[model samples]
Target chain A: MNSPLITRFIFLFVFLSLINAQDKNGYFSLENRLKFGNFLFCKGDYIRAIDEYNFVLTKQNNDTLKFKIALAYQKLERYDESENSFKELFTSQQFGSEAKFEYFKTLYLSDKFETMHKRIADDSFIESSISDKLKRLYNLKHLYSSKSIEDSSKFFQPFNQNESIELLKFYVRKQNLDNKSPALAAVLSAIIPGLGKVYTENYGDGITAFLLTGVLTFLAIDNFNADHNFRGWLFTTLAAYFYAGNIYGSAASAVLFNANVRMNFDSDLTLFLNKNNHFSSNSNLFCK
Target chain B: MKKYIYILILFFCSVSFSNDELARQYEYADKLFNDQNYFEAITEFKRLSFFDEKNVYAYESNYKIGIAYKYGGFYDNSVFYLSHAIRTTENIDERIQAEFQIVRCNILRKTTDRALQLLSQMEKDSVYSNHQNEIHYWKGWSYMISDRWDSAAESFANISDDHELKILSEQVSNDKYSVTFARVISYILPGAGQFYTGNYLSGLMSLAWNVLWGYLTINSFIENRAFDGVAIGSLLWLRFYRGNIQNAEKLAVQKNIEIANTALLYLMENYRGEKP
Candidate 1:
């Protein structure tokens, strides 16, 4: 009889202990889970961190956690998800300004400048506290994109005077890019076998082209003078191939040169902006 | 007497409570893993590893994290976590399981040298004597991934003579074109190498080009036009001759890649055996 009674007591104790476990501040509790999510967020494991945050959100409404989920998506480069998450907190009193600012930043980072520009044009959507920061991001978007900016004064309105001068240089550089024309290169090469390559700064290839064409042409004329008709015809064909090939090659070189100039300018602008933190708020503010 | 019984029950509950909680956490993470939610499963397993302060779930949590990362194609992270599993466990079988997984990750990531090194080390160990066939299997796979078909055949032969992988490796080795033979033959006979590599059209074209240019240069020399001979010999005849050799070498290499990739594709798609 006592053995049966002990078994029952053991079962009862396990059952009651499990109930207490649920009520206690254990690992699965809402509070403990929130803390764990924050820890994961800080540890740079944002994908897993989002899972923890979403779990906590299912149980309660917390603006800070919501903001964190958006920021984590941004870090993961899941911009669409980040945009939707930030959109949810647009009306939040505490995180509303930060969410609005981060939402535009997400769009900017996603390279959706057109959409971001349209959104920024709506002054009603802008929050007062983060308006200046949003304006800075808006102007930076223009510099990063291919869309032309007309009004210099309006484009530089949000930056400091010193910063404005620096940005103007970038703006001017973008507008007056040193791009060589493929048509002009082809025409020049047609006039002289290697002149286009020389104009495009490909001196080694230009010199080789000049020497190859000059030698082949001289050989064709000399063979004809010596009554070597077969060799003369062969040299003429070879010269024609080289001449046409050099013209086509010079046009390609010009196009490649222009692409490199554009690529260099874009990379330089990106490097400068990254070095200056995009002239806006630091992206690390959410974690703090 | 009742108070003494109550104290014993309370002490038992406290002791078992932490264990049960850790076990429950492990079960939840395992469930997520079974559901194919790998990212969340990793987080939960990490959480279990964090709170199981007595290390009750250490080996299990680490091993599962490794498997989850493997499933997610994160070979580097899989090796890292599986190494943790190997270190945490004292059981020989469990250690071997983790070690095998690390080897698999290395093979999958194309770090064949590392994979072969680990397999060799396992082969030398008395503790892994029972896993000889498994070691040979992975070593064969490592060789296969590196396109060393002959070595792969030799390694798989250590498992059994007629094993499917061994046979496949042998077939691949037999079917491959010899790059050196192709190059040497093309040097002797202008397009013979291309014909040997099964490029009949290219072979005919190359032979025609070489013959036409060769005759023109020799005839020019016979006609006492030394400049014509020099120009044709250096420019036309030599260019076609060198191009024949290069084409033969390139075709042989290309054919070999095709042969190896076909067998590897078959293994990936049709082989019912476990793979890295």
Candidate 2:
């Protein structure tokens, strides 16, 4: 009985030693691979790093190892694969706040702007480490970049009264910033030709129209005096209508131009403040 | 010694369990493919393919994967996987299916010349005789895309006077109406062709507007309001007169489109016909 018990003890000792050796070997290999992967990632050898990380993932058992594998995939620009890995890490219990932040960054870098905006909107994604000012700035940038002007206005409206006003003005200015609405101005001018120039806010254009109409009237009168009655009558009628139309058009165009200018000025100021981190950061700081 | 034996047995059991699980997964994927859940089916098939690299069903699995992509509107992926299936499979039936599917994928991708070449090659082969009807149908569609109306009509006519295909042939043939006649009728009388095409309300509206403008200009001229006459005659009367002729031709063309679309929809939904 004593001999049997001693043999059992010896067997148990050998079994324990074998298990320890296997664990050590597995962990050492995983660590070495991870180190190499990090080096490759820093060198911008993303493809090789991805391969190494994938190898580690297949051989290692740790959840943390899995998260690093996903990060390496992101560095390789294998966005779809990286998103999958990060999503898995997010679902698992092994990741902490740092992992969560990196996961959000991965999502943002992937141009998944809409998803990132929603994530930031939810307070659960914001921890004590990330400043609220930075969060607001990110949200604003996403608001401007991902959404249409009309959509951005709606999104920015909830931030603050002054910010909303500023954004609205910027969008208005950006609308006609390129000055490509000449055809629209032309149509308005045709309705009263100098009127179009006034609509586009060219005051000199209104004066030019008045002078052209006057000269044509004078030519018609002079031609009629010289007995070119048909040509005179044609010029006179065209000159009469154009002169009246120009006056009407100029007034209408002036109002439209002023409105457009005011809208653009408001927008420009808001965009400038938003870009320089003046509005959102200061507002967030005050709120805190 | 007993403990060591138990440990070895445990490892063997785990490996066998994994193999069994993989087999089960493959079976599940096959069922999904049969059910036409191609997107999800491809995912499961890929997973099984990864785990069991030497699976005898790999050829069938890859073939089905391609078919699933084809049915799911992913033509490029379908072509890629179907080519893989063709290269890998020894099964004659699957090979024929893959070849036909590659042609079908090319057609959907708008690579008509490639599809035509494949169809032409298949037509010369005795083994592909059973696929003639499908090939003809695709050829007709190709002709339609290239706007070769006569050839499209001929292709559709070659199909057996089966009820569905006969209707499609009739639709293609009926679209050959004279646009010149439609334009002539509109020029002779504003909105007459629109009325002929069963658009009485639009025809009457066009006639009323044109007649009103024509009358106003003539009346202004009679009253010696020359300026008013000239302005209304050039801007309003001429615009409406031109618009009436153009509208008449447009109405005829629009009616033709409606007729063709109705027939096409019927063919797609109700016909128990062979598909391309």
Candidate 3:
């Protein structure tokens, strides 16, 4: 057989090799950890799944693995972490169109619509992979949320003519420009008690404000002539203030009412669009 | 394989054991607190504190127990637990809150002397001096309850620059004067005092009615209409003069009440000051 010293050396070498292999096997292997994370994610134990996925990320160096980490964070409602991961993947270029799409989705979900719009505006290549319908929706949302109505209208021009009309109407109403028209009406009515309200489409209130103020003023004047100076002055002052305040208040009320009407219209339009569109759309789509 | 399986089972079991126990206790306590079953929540927290003496939540539990007692109107019990929380807790916020509650408990128990002493100490402390306005407000109330009107007025006047409390203090002080003014004005020119004190229309009406009756009585007497003069003078003129004086007093009183109400409304709706 072999010499005793050589035999002992060989045994020791094998034992050391076995120990090294066991050490390499890891406390929890990357693959096993990922599997555990996925299992937890599927079972809706998102918090634990995120922990496992994070553990895998420390040992693993793969884009797909990173994507899974982001998905896990998303599942856990750790939106800030998920958005950062998606943003990293989007910039890497290796992750391709799917990564870009997911990045946009994460940004949208996090209410980072402005950044999503900038990405779409800067990268022409993003449009080729994402559907035309999706692009339209994203653009619409971006426009709707944008402060500039003119810019929003320009973005919405390609979708529907009716949408343009509706948007302009909304813009006017939101800006409270409806008050200008009602103010004119109120001024006209002030010239004659119920006339301004008729012009403003509030015949009832205008008539009431006018009649009450007119009667009070007449009574006050009559009382003054009859030598009831105190009573006369009291009613006269009350009438004057009420009449002036009514004119100013009516204009303001009309503007507020129009703003409410415009808000309602936009809501109805959004609901209609959502019902007709089959692809799941986001509320931000109206922003564009 | 069997060995690995056994290791995994042990790990899972250990995790479940600690996590499940902690979560169950947390949820049970939360539910009890939410349901306003504060008494039961205190017991659970006590159990938790017993199990884990170093747990920070034990301080919270003690504080909450004091709060529950305070809300239940058990001022003595509130003071005891709140004092315990203040002495035992390391958290500055919790300690400050507990100290405040202890002071509040003393006030509720009508131990104003102790409450005032504690408030004075707090006023001296740089950390709690910012709460002096509230302290003075309560002190004023305590003084009022003790029938120390002048002291109450002084305390109220100290913070009268505070929009709401100033008005309240003014009303309390004004009530004393309103009663005096109404009686004094009635003793003066029948209704001239009422007019000077802001009852214009009523004062003029009183004066006019009284003078007319007086004039008619005098005119009849001068015309040698003795029977008519006596009847008018004794009945109409005398009755009107007395009626004018009474009206003046009533109007003055009413005006004072209106002023108090106006000040009260200002305190309730517009004053930015601290309230009881």
DockQ winner between candidates 1 and 3: 1
Best by lDDT: 1
lDDT of 1 by residue, B109-136 (tens): 9999999999999999999999999999
Lowest summed lDDT window (length 10), candidate 2 chain B: B161-170
DockQ of 3: 0.02
Error of 1 at B255 (Å): 1.2
lDDT of 2 at B12: 59
lDDT, residue A103, model 1: 94
TM-score rank, highest first? 1, 2, 3
* RMSD to truth, every model: 4.5, 12.7, 17.1
> What ranking of all candidate models by DockQ puts the best one first?
1, 3, 2
| Candidate 3 lDDT over residue span A174-199, tens digit each | 44434346767667757876666666
By DockQ, the best candidate is 1
Cα error, residue B101 of model 2, in Å, equals 2.0
Candidate 2 docking band: incorrect
After superposition, the stretches of candidate 1 with alpha carbons farther than 4 Å from their true spots are: A1-29, A32-36, A43-45, A126-128, A139-178, A224-230, A264-280, A285-288, B1-5, B31-47, B50-53, B90-92, B120-133, B159-164, B223-235
Model 2's DockQ score: 0.02
Question: Between the candidate structures 1 and 3, which one is better when assessed by lDDT?
Answer: 1
Model 3 spans > 4 angstroms off: A1-52, A61-83, A91-95, A105-117, A131-134, A142-186, A193-200, A269-288, B1-276
Candidate topping TM-score: 1
